[model samples]
Target: MNRRSLLAIAASAACLLSMGLAHAADQDTLAAIREAKTIRVALEFGRPPWGFKDDKLKMSGSDMEAAELLASDLGVKLEIVEVTGPNRIPFLQTRKADVVLSTFSITPERLKVIDFSAPYASAVQIVGAPKSLPLKSEADLKGKRVGVTRATTGDVELTKKAKDFGVEVVRFDDESTNMTALASGQVDIVIQEPATLTAVAARNPQRQLEPKFIFTQFPVGIGLRKNDPALKSYLDQWVKTHMADGKLNAIYRKYHGTDLPAEIVKPTN
Candidate 1:
């Protein structure tokens, strides 16, 4: 090429490099974790095999195990924060956590605000039907009462489709109330993610709450702030590497085979 052309190309390259750095520069979420050598992740401590403390008061579960690996890969120590469905996104937005390593799902609407890693697991939606309820099919649920956690996708799905399914919907603020209302016949069924319900059933084996109906299935992913693509990539790569090597499956099997928990493994898309 000519000397003038080479000079122009070099000048353009310098400008582009500066713009890229401005955009990709680590945010506070990653910077703090990098400096401290620990990734602070949000988890739902209420559920076992995810984040609930063990008998010795230690964070124990597949999510906990998974996040621990992720921290190590980033060359950092681990810091965990407890979070729930509603607050998961807000926590990432405010940099409360570097990434929500909890069982967060990827949704189109949510992606407008938070970027998500590639899915790690599928979050299946199912129902807990009491034997007394004659909910043999979707048709039988007509005019019947159903309970779901407030602000959860289960709530959105049931509320939108209830009238057509011949059901009325009631939402509870917490999982305890949702399950309790269903057991008492106040609601015909309670809707929740299959993994969580699996954990619940394991905790209360004395009561058999069969999942009679499954309505929706979606992949679970880590949530990150819009600009935090670096963190998203870190999580995605970690999941991919471990899953391919069978480490993820081994963890799932160990917990799933015991009273500690069972998993509702969602179909990966």
Candidate 2:
């Protein structure tokens, strides 16, 4: 071969090698977890029924149970990494956690940063307040003070329509904080998932807080880094299998005292 032709071939081979390495990296997540024998699952520790630390400070909830199952399925040790609503996706993107089981909802903005498994759970954002309150619908929220966890679906949705609803939004760092605000009467109402609202009301019956109005439905899923088709596919299949076998329903019932939502169990996309 001529000198120039040999040089060109060498450059092409190097380019191809780099591309192959990049592709391999995309599939490395599952392999890395297997090799490490530890699967780090991120979850929010304050959202009860999904995930939360018990009185003993041990993590226990449906999301935590799901993480435990996933780690066991992979034959790896489970390392629970507590994350907040705002930092969950960042943890996945920074490779700080292999998977996030923090009741993460699949949305267009979130899909841009990370990929999600098939639906694992579903929750509706609702306005929760005392029965004495005049809350009947979105229109009733006018001039009311609403508390929401910052950066959550409830916060995003409420902030978007607060002007129209004529409500004041009080942002908190976590659900517990927001719930406390509502319970202590610092906020007239709280925008949060139905699970948390129910749990909060159960714990503090004196608050008289009840579901006022549903704002939107949030289909929750396990979150992972984008571009990892192998890991994403594995999680999707795992979700499908568990949903079919009723394992997910058992977990849901254990926490929520109800069957898993049918739509979440049979996720369309």
lDDT of each: 0.71, 0.87
* Candidate 1 overall lDDT versus native: 0.71
**After TM-score superposition, what is the CA distance of residue 161 in candidate 1 from its true location, in Å?**
1.5
Clashes of each: 4, 0
TM-score of 1: 0.77
Candidate 1 per-residue C-alpha lDDT over 1-269 given as tens digits, one digit per residue, 9 for 90 to 100: 99999999999999999888876765545666787777888887664445567788888887888788777778888888888767888887777787887767677767788888777665667877645555556677677778887756777777778879877788787666776665555765777766666665666665566677787766677778887655666676777786667676677566544321123232335
User: TM-scores of all models?
Assistant: 0.77, 0.91
lDDT of 2 by residue, 114-213 (tens): 8999888887788888999887788888888889999899888888899997889889998889998887888868888888888888888998889988
Best model number under lDDT: 2
Model 1 lDDT at residue 144: 71
Q: Whose TM-score is greatest here?
A: 2
